[model samples]
Target: MRRVLALAACASATVYFEETFDSGIGERWQTSEWKDPMGAWVWTSGEWYTNEAKAKGMQASEDMRFHAISAKLDAPASTVDKELVVQFTVKHEKKDYAFCGGGYIKLLPGEVDPKAFGGDTPYAIMFGPDLCGYDISRIHVIFENKGENLLKSDEIKLDYSDKDEFTHLYTLHLKPDGSYEVFFDQKSKASGKLEDDWAFPSKEIKDPAISKPSDWVDTKRIPDPAAVKPEGYDDIPAEIPDPEAEQPEDWDAEEDGEWEPPMIDNPDYKGEWKAPMIDNPDYKGEWVHPMIPNADYAPDTYAKYPDLTTLGFELWTVNAGSIFDNILVTDDKAYADKMAADTWAIIKEGEKEAKDAWKKANKDDDDDDDADVDDDEEEEEEEELKDEL
Candidate 1:
């Protein structure tokens, strides 16, 4: 592909973080002993449907538990006038996966005690998909500012991938131009100016001096004074007996009693009537508040994060079995693309096939189980019949 070619062309871009979880989990990663302890992470391919050994990923091993882990980079990378790209893959493989948790990874600022990292620890950016029921299924892009975290204003809905339980890719590209692009499974999901999308303080505010005039009539329409309800409008009933009704010939007065015809919708009926509406003569158009330069808003280099020393995941999940793998934090988009193609794209089809095969195997087993149960029931019935005889 052209992306692979581009990657070869620009082979000089720096790679800040890369983890496949092949090994060195203890050597490279730090599991937090933060106040509530931490959930265990097992290197696994999940219970069903996998690409064999290739499917091995970092899986959250416990349900209803907190997980906090981080790995230190050999050299911390900074995003000063440089492009920063972060990408990772997640597989929610649990059959009954009901997520009330976070899978978003954090890019920790500078060097700090990795074990002490918790919910309170400051992070440069938190990015990934977070799902809780149907209402909240979105890839959160939150950034920290002055010890306070600011969540993105724009909602980046889920990619709505066909295979919800299969492994999917999430890629975030933060460029130097104050813009960002988020990709789901190599497909562009959301792209925009970071300033416009994130909860940054507005550059301008409503003019404090100006207020709406008291005489301004905002009501665009009003009931017409001349229009009136019909004199007998309220007197009409909604339904009446059919006028053409005749008693059935089979009906006997003593046996069937008096039979009445079913009521039909009344054609002459008129419901509660209101005066007709007309455009108000004194109506004024909707007023927009004039904006003035905000005195409080002072622009800064918000895009730059000088110290991105550690890559971490601090999460809490009700149903475990979310596998994370193929993480890459690099400056080169081309390289990241190539890496994704090499890892996710190639193995995805095989994974689906494997999943189907697993499902078929399980179904066959269930059928066998049902057959056994039927046989046992049949024997019991035969024994009962013999005793009766």
Candidate 2:
């Protein structure tokens, strides 16, 4: 019989890993650390081995390379409404690589299949430092909730440049819906919507008690952890919900004078822009973004027509040189045209009505003025007469 552990509702699920069974290095934990340090990313690889027989799980291997720990957790498939927080510490000896160590949580169906490792359909959360400087190897979250099945990728950069003694906290808040809200430390960084139709299994149970992979080895029948109330954890009250959760208020022109493109909502243009392709013969490399006086049109504004420089211009991806006159530049004219016309279209429509209203109000004020007895008007009329003289 397999021993099971039940998770409390709307609370932190704490499981202790005994150091005697498998330690961090001895467990051979897998991560993105196997590739060339210079290449894109390396996947760290290892397995968990336990000494206890009854306390063991269904998925244990003997590739010893970790610190001793007994209980290793497999995240529940659909823990929506549950904030899954993982706190751990990493010690680095070298500060040269800066982005030397990084890891990602594989929130998917099975052990990452090489065939689906970098495929467009996988789910993951990444954390680490970048090689380049300025103290920034923060955590980044990636998913494929939208876009081409292959290009389903997104990132959230964190600030973890100081590799000194630090306790890292990664929180995955499962929304009421199947989507997710990821936070580094306590700061919420990114939120993504999960498609309603995507097939997400509720649980994956691997019984460490069974050894033989025979036809009778039931992979589907994972015994649920018996219902036991969690102890030692503070039943803390929930914080008040933030209505504008991830929105940056200062990005608005009326609120903040600084330039921030991704924070703009309901922009003037509503057309999708694409990068320059071979389809257009006049495809010169003229997708440069122009400078703006107001800088309000800095991000998300397209470049000149056919110069769709803003093709991949996401809020998180726009840069300094890319923002032209408060507009994001593109490499294609069609994209630029759509952005310029759409944005100005809103202002133009409003301006026409505002101008007409202003003219009508001025005429009414002039007609209703106390023309025969107003000293202020008489003084203005005398001044006009003096100027004429």
Candidate 3:
């Protein structure tokens, strides 16, 4: 929590879009009916209290429905040769229901109707935290190219450290060098060249005119041909009758069945012998497909979006009440970092105290029971507020 207001004077960065949702949110943002019946989006501090009104965010106010909302940027953001940074914060207030939901946002390119933005709307990039069931937890970093949304081949796994109800930041930094980095709560989580983790076109491809030799021996090991099994090894039985069994003196032979010894594993029984494995003398190394210069190979220019005009969220959450705030899209990493410090870092401690106070005020008198509202009841209370459009 640097709480750094010192870096506010820097003007080298270009901020295409920024919002704290402190006030005037609905005037700049719009909702979509992409799902016909969509979840409600509210601007509040949720059930908990916050000392700073800026901490109040865009919350998915309902449960078990889709939510799509977007806002036009002050100007179109272009990633021609400069670094692009997308950062936002989220809080999953429902502890038990945080497992199945999404808190990610997207950057749209070209003309987009903010009111009509939905899952089908084309976007340049998407970045944020997402959890579905116990197995799927990750900070999604997806980019759209050639009409397909490309996901990282190697996933970004999320764990207990990143999953919490407290406010936390998610950031994605994409550079012009085909490199990118992902951060969680201001700490680096993953970084690599885009092509290494994405489905970018390769510079070369396997030659279609050539193949590995048919006689190539790829086996690394083989059984020893000279090894022989010992004579009469199969004579030993796997099991034998118990040698210590004895009949009780009071047992009645006429009324009861004859006593039988329990079978046991034979101590001296030898198992079937196997030849020792050795390195294959004639084996060639594993065949690698011959590669050639592919005519289809091209530099990944799709990474750059020249006309990105909107920033928004379009996701489905089984459990709502996740808050999103401090949305930022900038051309400088230093600027975004400073903004984060001045906002989330400074207000986090006070927010925590306020949240605790609110919880205490709402605690049950019995003490043994939790006062939190039941999620199922809330789900039933939530219904689509149909759009007039």
Candidate 4:
């Protein structure tokens, strides 16, 4: 154990891993065999124009299905530290802006076959955003403890509405105290205890033998027994003839059956009789399930991943147009925060400005094209008149 601690201390002293994709994916990154004939991983200077600058990034899919890519750290790092931090940025720029793709990454352990990586491949941690149709649009933070992969039990609602079409930064931090924090664009979004958030069976559960008494009055209100229906209430008809409606002066009684007044909804008619309700004096409060020590439940001491080796991105996308960049994995919170501030903060503001400029340029081009079409139409009409003359 002494030697192990010494080795881990040496490994954690230096920067664990980082990627910026400025010069394109080099020899370190490897991609899986293309599942579809048209599927591809594209490296572009910028997917969209934002002010005058373009975002140079890597896109994992090409509007195709079953796309997968992985970037294994040249020097695999250990996650067996007092704290672990992971951060990355993603941009979804699909033409229609409605796409089903993964913005998350997977951190793998031990040696992994980069050529054959897929969804079933086991990973130490999986964190990022995922969207599918209308229902699934959330950031997923899953941790592999023991032999089981446990997902956070709480639903994380991400902002993926139609108007949301910009780059977003995601960060995850795991502490030795068995707590975790999730951040979006440097803002703390969610945090909780690992044991409480994950789908681990509770150490304490509701007592099966305990139940509320049969006579317990849970209803808050009760019908008044003394309240009675008013006199002649039932005599009021649901409909009555309109006395104000005038009949035609022509004697059409024999031609059109009997001259009867048209029936209309009666103003005085009440639909039904019901007793008034009042607060019940015997009403009891809400019943809470009594919990006791679960005989089958056993607490888990969160294990450290001292052998964490590889990190990768394995995904399946339907309308692929997600750009991933600026990946960082380390045990240093200060380093992670600094990287976010230096990279994301600078690029985010520029990206927004470039996006607006691009929209204006495209609109102007469209307007010019429309004017040329109108001029051609006028020339064609003049030519037809000359030929007639």
Q: What is the TM-score of each predicted model, taking all chains together?
A: 0.75, 0.29, 0.81, 0.70
Instruction: Write the residue-wise lDDT of candidate 2 on 1-389 in tens digits.
Output: 11112232212232211111121223322222222221211111111111122111111111112111111223233233322322222212122322233332333332443322332323432222222222344554433322212211444555433332222334444444445555543356766654322222212333435454333332333333443434422342233334355646445766666543343343333334333232333334333343334322221111101110101101111111111011211112233233334332332233334434444555545555563345367557545643553
Off by over 4 Å in 1: 1-9, 35-37, 48-53, 95-101, 133-135, 159-163, 223-278, 296-300, 358-389
Model 1 C-alpha lDDT per residue in residues 163-197, reported as the tens digit of each score? 26678889999888778899988889889877687
Tens-place lDDT digits, model 3, residues 227-299: 8887887888999998987778877878877877789999998676788899999999899999998675555
Output the lDDT of residue 123, model 4.
Answer: 88
- Name the TM-score of candidate 3: 0.81
Give the higher-lDDT candidate: 3 or 4. Answer: 3
lDDT of all the models against the reference? 0.77, 0.29, 0.79, 0.71
Colliding pairs, model 3 = none
**Candidate number that wins on lDDT, 2 or 3:** 3
| Model 4 agreement with the true structure over 135-223: per-residue lDDT tens digits | 56788888787679988788676753422457788998888777888988877878988778886667898899989888878899989
**Model 3 spans > 4 angstroms off:** 1-8, 97-99, 132-135, 226-268, 273-278, 294-296, 299-302, 364-389
Looking at model 4, how many pairs of residues clash?
A: 4
What lDDT, from 0 to 1, does candidate 4 have? 0.71
Model 4 root mean square deviation, Cα atoms: 9.6
